[model samples]
Target: AQSVTQLDSQVPVFEEAPVELRCNYSSSVSVYLFWYVQYPNQGLQLLLKYLSGSTLVESINGFEAEFNKSQTSFHLRKPSVHISDTAEYFCAVSDQSNYGGSQGNLIFGKGTKLSVKP
Candidate 1:
């Protein structure tokens, strides 16, 4: 079945450091890629998405990801992170294109926990 995979369960970084969260997806039909961030004690918030157009997408908070069709990957990245950046990041895929008029849901990965230290 179609699924999303998060290569790292956890990532630790200093107050100011670069980080990358790896993600890969497998699906028979076309899909939309999304990256979500869940801060502590809060709901998941959309970080970025790739539906069409440029393969590269970025979030307002300095996060970015590139959709690679050949590799079936959409890895999340940040050039520099702060303590507030600590959170659980999830990679998700939606087969909305194939669903046509039907309701669609996101297929999420296990998630990568990002821990930022002082």
Candidate 2:
């Protein structure tokens, strides 16, 4: 079975602080990694993804993560954060074999709560 695991359930931080959310996965076959963010009362938005070619992937809003095949991990990091970044983050995985001509079924972790204070 392909599954994703998020190490942190909640992370609290002051405004303009740095943060990281850890993620790991176990799968028998190839997989794709993704980080998604969801603000209160909103849908999840794609933060970043590790599809291929690069071990390190970054989001447009200053977050980055590295895919480690050996360890089956992909951890998210941001040098500095804002109160606006307060949201819930989820790590997801989709097995390549399941990608049947479209976005495959996404298996999400329990989720990580990121609280940025002011």
Candidate 3:
């Protein structure tokens, strides 16, 4: 069994401030970790992912997350955030198991609502 836990339900930051969204997971086997962002009234978008290879993965939008297997944590961070960066962020995990012959479902955290202020 695998599960993700977001330590914070909400984070408030001023514009151009550094921010970090914490995430931790527990699983018996190896897993893939991801961060997704959902803008107001829109669908979720992939922010970054850690599948294999390098433990440090980055997104084009100045966000980075490092996969720490020993800690079972994949924390998302950005040096400076903009007002537009405010959104609901979700942390998800998926194992290699394909349930019912379908793609394995992603277990997601409750999400952290990032509120960027002016």
The segments of candidate 1 whose C-alpha lies over 4 angstroms from its true place after superposition are 101-103
Clashing pairs in 1: none
Query: Candidate 1's residue-wise lDDT over 1-118, tens digit each?
Result: 4699999999999988999999999999888899989998899998999988999999998999999999999999999999999999999998856557214888899999999999
In the predicted model 3, the residue pairs found to clash are: none
lDDT of 2 by residue, 50-111 (tens): 88898999988999999999999999999999988999999999877774521888999999
Worst 10 residues of 1 by lDDT: 96-105
lDDT of 2 at 56: 97
lDDT of 2: 0.92
Question: Could you give candidate 3's per-residue lDDT for residues 23-105 as a string of tens digits?
Answer: 99999977889999999999999999988899999999999999999899999999999999999999999985555321588
Better of 1 and 3 by TM-score: 3
lDDT of each: 0.92, 0.92, 0.94
